[model samples]
Target chain A: MDKETQPPAASSHPRHHAVPPYLLAAMAACDGAWEAPESMREIISSQPTLDKADGPVSVTRTRIATRARQTMLLDQALLHERSTAHQKLTWLIEPTGRLNRIISDAQGVEITPGTLIRSEGQKPSADIDVNRAYDGLGHVYGFLADLFKRNSLDGSGLVLRGTVHYGEHYDNAFWDGTQMVMGDGDGEIFNSFTSSLSVIAHELGHGLLQYTTNLQYQGQSGALNESIADVFGALVEQFVAGDDAAHASWLIGKGLFTKAVTGVALRSMIEPGTAYNDSILGKDPQPATMAEYVKTTEDNGGVHLNSGIPNRAFALFAKALGGNAWETAGSLWFNVIATRTLPENADFATFAEQTLLQARRDHGAGSAVESALKQAWDTVGVVPRLKENDDE
Target chain B: MSESLRIRVVRSGGVAGISRRGILELPAQEPSGQQDPDWFTMAHQALNQLRSIQEPATAPAVRDAFTWSLNIDGEDHVVPDQLLVGPARTLAEHVITLRGSR
Candidate 1:
């Protein structure tokens, strides 16, 4: 079939997937509902006496209500996932109302409203770090939810879980497959990574990418992925803080470093290399233009280094678009990432093309998209395919 | 030697204010080391003047060192070291020192 003419496939699987009438009725009575056999089994197992003992009608009703609430939460989670996948939006719902039994192993820990764990060595410093992580996550989550109407990172009402003081002097923050882990920075130059809103948002952006494009974290595609996080992270900070392009500092880790450090910031979106200049860490190595781009192995194929190019592109785009960065430029980038069919190894050229396509689709095929696209790529020394006689 | 108190006037936090911390060892008997009321009033005045001079509109016109000031008793004294300047984190330490010293 021709690609343009192909129709969306209708499922041919058995039609035994309808919600039971009783279940539907129960769900309708409540705000919402969901179903997970594993959760039900765990709940039932936890209250095995319910199976053996003849409880009062109220007791049975309470159990049913509890199960229904769990189901509702699961349903919400599913809905959030579907919405995020289809709409490029996130969802946030309180998890306390749900009945999912969380379990953890030695290596992993579950984060929930009630689950509290002490820090290693019972250090007071660890408590501070943990609290900061929690606050930072809450802020970023609220920013995404309030500003974009997103439920969560996955758009599937997923709980935002963060592990604080992860590892010994990890020196970085990262999103594992399931949770966000923050490292306490070395005391000399950096502090707790959780101190900055942008860093939290950046890690969450990684989760967003995983759910959306699942961009491979290597080479140019990796750089694009990293750049996407930085762009959104910076925008999240500005949006939540009510900062505008002119007023925003455009620094990634504006408050993550200690006072002893003489650097400007972790990274600068507007002026790449100018973020910092120090003797120990060397000058900001990021190159704003394509001519000076560094080809290195550090930072996962120079993920951080090459990111400066796209970072500057995003900054320029935001400045030209004016107003809040998240309003137009941010929306454009988010939509492009959501819609682009990116491979794991997609490079800068691929990203540029997809962005151009998205810009045209979003803003019309006019001078605005053309100029923005050209300027962005040209600034990074990536030559785009030219249209014949367009200059005239 | 007459006793003198060394007072450092540190300024931090603005659009792009840096974290600057400096010490001005004053002779304990310096004229500005008078009573607390006179010292505070002078410090307030000096801070106000410094802020006025560092207004966003005229920030570029003022030199970096101009951001710092020393209040002696009831008079303003300018200092040489610009102290801390740059991003938020860089200025955080100066804020700590200023608060701690006072």
Candidate 2:
């Protein structure tokens, strides 16, 4: 048969448009019969108006069918892109160990470890370990680019920059508006922050949130921002390692803790207590429930501590949804953050409501997104409006 | 005489004004008919318990009182008054030095 003339294989799945058996099953359940074209049309037409109360049911059905058809086309486009296989590319490095000079059409940019040349008072050390910082940044950058089609922290392809070994045995890593900074862990309880991929991803994720939602850095909204980073960071690690939610270890800093510290992990996604049993660190200090919620002043008004509530919620949601965390749960959270309409001070209840709304919009009202979102919030004691009665 | 496994606990990383080194030597000789399955396991558990007692904010203060136990040949030895140095890497290196028996 001529290459272009050959008919598409009937049994063979399309590279991009091939819907998973589960999704297909769900679509079938929405109507009836696996291959019923008529039911598929009905489900597709109704999807859009499902969120609206007064929209005609028939109109909604037609909208759902139309959307399904569009999604199938988008899937085909995604498959084609994958089939082309974007070549892994890199930019040339200068003699001073910098990619300062960007060559034409460079696929990736290099960030050099440097001191804050512009900071006036109390200039910290610039003697950063370039190799470690580079690797960490590179891994996070590659993750965003490969998975989400994100060019850089901002979708417009922002230049990535990092400073390593910032202070004398600095114990933390943080993103300072423009660039990411890593501290050589005071060789005791913690190691170099750049050593863990999750940490790097976590930091970069902060940058991503800044560019996207710009969530305020205090109270529940700030906690939500931090939690989003933690979720995405864990996902980046899991995605790179090709591990599912069940197989993945939800610890934020698995290797950062020194050998002297006897802890399973820094933070546990599945079971928060399992992260650390140490007396010095005070048993991970993370509460999985609102009842155990900590009201504190430290760590940016307990931004890090209170984050566990939302973090655990996301983890439970992903596990309940099953399969890849990034594919379903991750996408839902990302969409919520990306499309948030509330101010930065939005509380947990507000965030939960918005997430439920977004999930319903993205995936039908009573779809898997609804159940997963309900299950996740319920697990964390933040019952959504629909399931408030069911929650105990 | 049985081979002795000397496991050292090196402490590091905390605020200034704290000594950051300690060593626990576990002698290899144990009573006959008894076996210490995994020395590291027991030592780690003890270390974790010690860590949880220290407040994270006052890590430097607690570092001054750095202590740990090692199980060699079925016996536990507690090392006390350890120094808390710059970071985990330094402590790890110090532990290596103690393990080297130099």
Candidate 3:
């Protein structure tokens, strides 16, 4: 038979595994079915291997050996066992040292993981976002693992995926339930999202919240979600810069805005309502206290707006503690989100109560931690719930 | 609902964060003797198609994303990232595009 003819055994399965050009001739010369497991064959065929000889592409389709079937069955059982093991370890509990990241170039389009320019363990690319995303994700992973003693976002070392240069003149970054997406700014109001480590951390913080507390994305709960992201965002920045809470700027997106825009930063945790005050962007509408809380149907019930209350509360709580926010205040916040005590529909009042509970539980009743959390919440006018029955 | 339908579509959130709403009201039900069966069929078909679509799972809501809230008669339905698909999508495009002119 000619080398171009496909073997009868291979034709039966119709699932052709790509063979090396040399292997194709050899397999054709043999005129026999190849012996390999179905799953292993699939694994081999998916890899990109060159055909040394420029000829008709070769493929292997063959019968599964008895032992090979057993191995495949064992592999399936092992996969099931692993799945079951991790299923119970939900809430970002798994610790994976290897920070796997994938950076995609959106190419002025709004698509995810658009064109894969970089992958885990690969060297950096010429694109600034590729290298920046890789480094930024690495920094975040290190911060969480080294400081928090936790794994990546979702706790199982979830593959951190990022798309940079997403959309033409896009002006923002977001964590869309899966990966961190960055946009090259219009250069007038904003810069590259990767320009600030805090921005990256802030977006990743959303992922952590998703895998952890999963605070409702509307009203007070939504604000809490945003606040958690901002808090950790600042913590990530401080931890990386080795800055204490007092020294930390507590700005959510410090360098995100360009000089042309009249803004010190996007949002300020230290002084909630003072992030930015500009003509083009309008005045910063964040309210620092419950008295100044904005009641609006917009921005997910002013999530990004009212978050200032808790943001400032956290800043105060951490500053009053007189140390790194990530060490004391940050740990408490992480514990509040990581534990199952936090409900999906938790409001600011409930969150404060939980923080107080965690503080008392962690540091004993009437401890400094408990008082600091109480004072912070009280200062912000968020009265901690006495109990679930009487508070609401 | 009352042999008539009123739809108010509100498009909110985006880069500019400007919100706009437009209302499209269908004529009330004609008496049985005066009813146009073909017109009723068309109206029922359009409304059914619009209400049948459920938002796709895994459809991410990106930054500066647009969300749509459709108040049909009295019941309201909100779709994050506009949940565009089929007749509902076509109607939303028209409602949002022509919101200012109306």
Candidate 4:
């Protein structure tokens, strides 16, 4: 036969092997409803025995093995589908809910949510760390809600989750994208992470930024992220104590260090580099003004170091207003974020401009709030550009 | 077969945001008479592990997490604290704690 006119080979036809209806149903459910044969038997036995007179029940050994194998395959397929669907669901869910909080214990290992020790509305546990985490989360949630009208970090009632006692002598606390992880500290140099309220609030602030501008954590933008978190930390401490800006300590991690260390706290917002000076820790390298803006690649371009510039500016602005920092200053900053005009890689100058615009909108043109904000940015040597640029 | 090995470790970014550095110089191959220190084996193992798993090109910044920069011999490897594990972790801890134990 001519090649052009030749009939198609039988093997070349697309195969349409039929999938079992039961498997299709199981896959559609994808909820692990199909258990192992042994488990199914147990569940069956738990129910009333079907009529015993139904005949000899010819369940041959070979037949049972084949059924068990089929069940195993279905179970595996269901499990895989369940896992995939779970990932998709997690991505789709907006994480909206009430003020829900979950605290777990890592038990001195590098794991998170290791053991669920406490949940919302549960009684306090014997472990003080768990209680502290629970209470701290509550305080932070209250601060955000009462002051900024923010439901939670995401402004959508996202559940606040924390893991305490994360690692042996971990000596640190961090936000690991999904939740907060706190360490017990090495004791020689530092104390328990939960000992400071600012630390807890600061971690949550990162989550807030994640849901907000989602700022790029590098160089100037990274410094803004750290600075905003510190701002939230200080504000929460002040709000809880009912202390005004003047009375507030403006310290980020006070009482976080052991007596063996000479540091009063991790970072001082009002006076950035003055927070610590020790033989072991050296000296805090944060610069309080743009004149001293550090330029480096380490620490995400010295995020913690250069945040001092903005930190001091905020402290100055609050103190200049001379009342509850959370009232005008806090509201001003929160409004800037709520506006959502900030780009992911917004620079210091860009943020300073937004604060100016926000101040003008809230307090009117050339108001005292705007004046203080301008002076604050000027003191830090960050001059907002005359023309507003697109931050999209 | 004796060779000298020098390693420098610079640790930055914790809750404190303090930067610390330490350097260690020890014989790489076992010396003729004296036995190698514990860090000697750890250093070799860390380098081997680094070779096995090359440092990731990009790592998401964890809040208040430490970042370590290691200078072994003359080459440099910057590893985030979250990724520092096994022998590499032990060696980094030892260097930071002892601050050049010889």
Q: After superposition, how far is residue A190 of candidate 3 from its true place, in Å?
A: 1.8
Model 3 chain B weakest lDDT span, ten residues long = B31-40
The residue-by-residue lDDT of candidate 3 on A92-188, one tens digit each, is 1233346889888999987776998999889879888779888889888988876655568765567889889988887667777788888898898
**TM-score against truth, every candidate:** 0.56, 0.56, 0.67, 0.77
CAPRI grade of model 3: incorrect
Instruction: Say which candidate scores most in DockQ.
Output: 4
DockQ of each: 0.01, 0.02, 0.13, 0.47
Model 2 Cα lDDT, one tens digit per residue, A106-225: 111122244333221223334334555555566676666565555566544566676666565656666656666666776988888777778778877888877666677656776777
Q: Output DockQ, candidate 1.
A: 0.01
lDDT of residue B74 for candidate 1? 40
TM-score of 3: 0.67
Tens digits of lDDT, candidate 4, A127-211: 9889989999999999876655456786567789999999999888999887889999889988899999999989988888777
lDDT, candidate 4, at A143: 86
The candidates score, on chain A by TM-score, as follows 0.68, 0.68, 0.75, 0.74
Given candidate 1, what's the lDDT at residue A43?
36
- Mark the 10 consecutive residues where model 2 chain A has the least summed lDDT: A89-98
lDDT of 4 by residue, B1-102 (tens): 547888888888876677777887776576634644466667778988776766657647467788898887787888888788998888887777766631
Write the residue-wise lDDT of candidate 1 on A1-392 in tens digits.
13232111112112212434234224222221122223233333343222233345543433343333333333343455576563421212322221111111112222222244432223333366666655666666676565544456654456666667554543566666566666666677777777888887887787777666667665677778778988878988898799987788999888777787678678898898888777555577778987877775434456676788888888887777678888667866776554333455777777776677556544566757557766867776776443353211
The candidate, 2 or 4, that scores higher on lDDT is: 4
